[model samples]
Target: MSQSTAKAAAADASASAALRARSEVARLISYIVIGSGAAFLSLRASTLPTSRWEPLGAGSFPELVFGVLAVLCLTAAVRAVIDIRKAGGANRLGTSFAKWLVARRYSFALFGLLVVYLALLPLGGFSLTTFVFLLIAQLMIAGISKKTLIQSLIAAMIFSVGLNMLFAEVFNVFLPRGVLFAG
Candidate 1:
């Protein structure tokens, strides 16, 4: 394999081992969140009586989503445990996991951006949030460039406006407009 590829593989192995060594704590946390979410939804569902069109009433959607999330978390816990068990031996992962870790660097930035977007939605409108998110994302991956910044800002504006219009006008869904809407 290539030198970079080998280095990535080594990095992945080390990261996986480190993550696995702490799997028990991670698994416990996942179990708590997933279990609580699932149970809350389940209880909500039980409190609602069956309807003509929908059997589970208002609780069905949240319950279904929570149940699926719980199952996925449970699966993650199982895999983490398995990885921890097999980490010592020679049975290591190939390039797939290594490449995934590399790609996750960008994905994590996107995740942080989303968190900020959601948090700031109540303070600033979608347009402002999108502008900041795009600028930061572009800066993180490829260093600052005037052209890139302009393009990103324009794209962010279009996306934010388009999505806002679609959700508010077409879908009739309410989005947080922040203090701007109140004034």
Candidate 2:
């Protein structure tokens, strides 16, 4: 092969290896996080109160589910660790993590929006809070333009107000009313 072609091929291989290493590291992180959460829940579930009358206690189901989840997470974490070690032990973890943050910037923004939406739900009211959040999130993702703005507003109104009305009137399930709208 030509020298230039051979160098290009080597570069491609290096890039592929780096991508693989990053993926394994990300998997390891996810497994660790999920495992910790599962373990905590399992422990909490164990201390829950049981029922006297019924054969199965209130905590029985939760305990079983969380225990199983914890075990599965542990198993997955071990496998991820093995993969990471084989891929050279996450030496580039910081680099991969920084790249991940940049790549998923929009996802982080959406999560932030969700947190705000939930926090303001009680105070602002469900419909209003949801409507504003939806409109903003949609516009943030889809970008602002004349057509998109109108469409997103329509969509936000329909989903926010329609769901509230449907749940309250049709399903006879009332959502939490905002303190502002309580009176």
Candidate 3:
């Protein structure tokens, strides 16, 4: 083949590979989210008590919600599988997952921060926990710098304290005060 033809062919191959990688990643994410969410919802719905006293019963809402969610998830999973097949199957799923992980390391780190924030919420209280979570998350996402640090601190304070005050005073809703700070 000529040099120009060879270059064009290589470019086409590269584009095709990228497309396939993206398709595989989409399929994997869809499968994980929809499948897991459906299962979780189903379990949660099952745990809700069925009572004859109430017209619809306590489990009615949860059961309905879970049923709908399961149907939607099934549809999405089927679609994802079809897309994966069209993109040449999951032969490169591992490679695609690795590349996606590397590319989204920061996102994964932020998710970890969120998990920590949730775990500490009851212990540290809403205001304090939210402030710390926001500060750390903002710094990690926006990078550390004098100006960004100041901005993050201000934003965290405004969001945590300001929102807490609003909820407590205006909305008449009290957030957790934690064992240490509870009065």
Which candidate number has the best TM-score? 2
Per-residue CA lDDT of candidate 2, range 1-183, in tens? 999999999999988887777777777788778878887887898788878899888778888888888788889878877887786846778888787678899999999999999999999898999999999999999999999999999999999999999999999988778999998
List runs of model 3 lying over 4 Å from the truth: 1-13, 25-29, 32-89
lDDT of candidate 2 vs native? 0.87
Q: Give the Å shift of residue 110 in candidate 2.
A: 1.2
What are the lDDT scores of the predictions, listed in order? 0.70, 0.87, 0.83
Model 1, 1-183: lDDT tens digits are: 999999999999898765555544445456657777776776777666666796567767776777777677777767655665666422433333454456578887789888987898888877667667776877777777898778777777777777888899989986777787656
The RMSD of every model to the true structure, in order and in angstroms, is: 8.1, 4.1, 5.0
Query: Model 1: which residue pairs collide?
Result: none
Query: What is candidate 2's TM-score against the reference?
Result: 0.69
Candidate 3 lDDT over residue span 101-130, tens digit each: 787899999999999989898889999999
TM-score of each: 0.46, 0.69, 0.64
Backbone clash total, candidate 3: 0
RMSD of 2: 4.1
Best by lDDT: 2
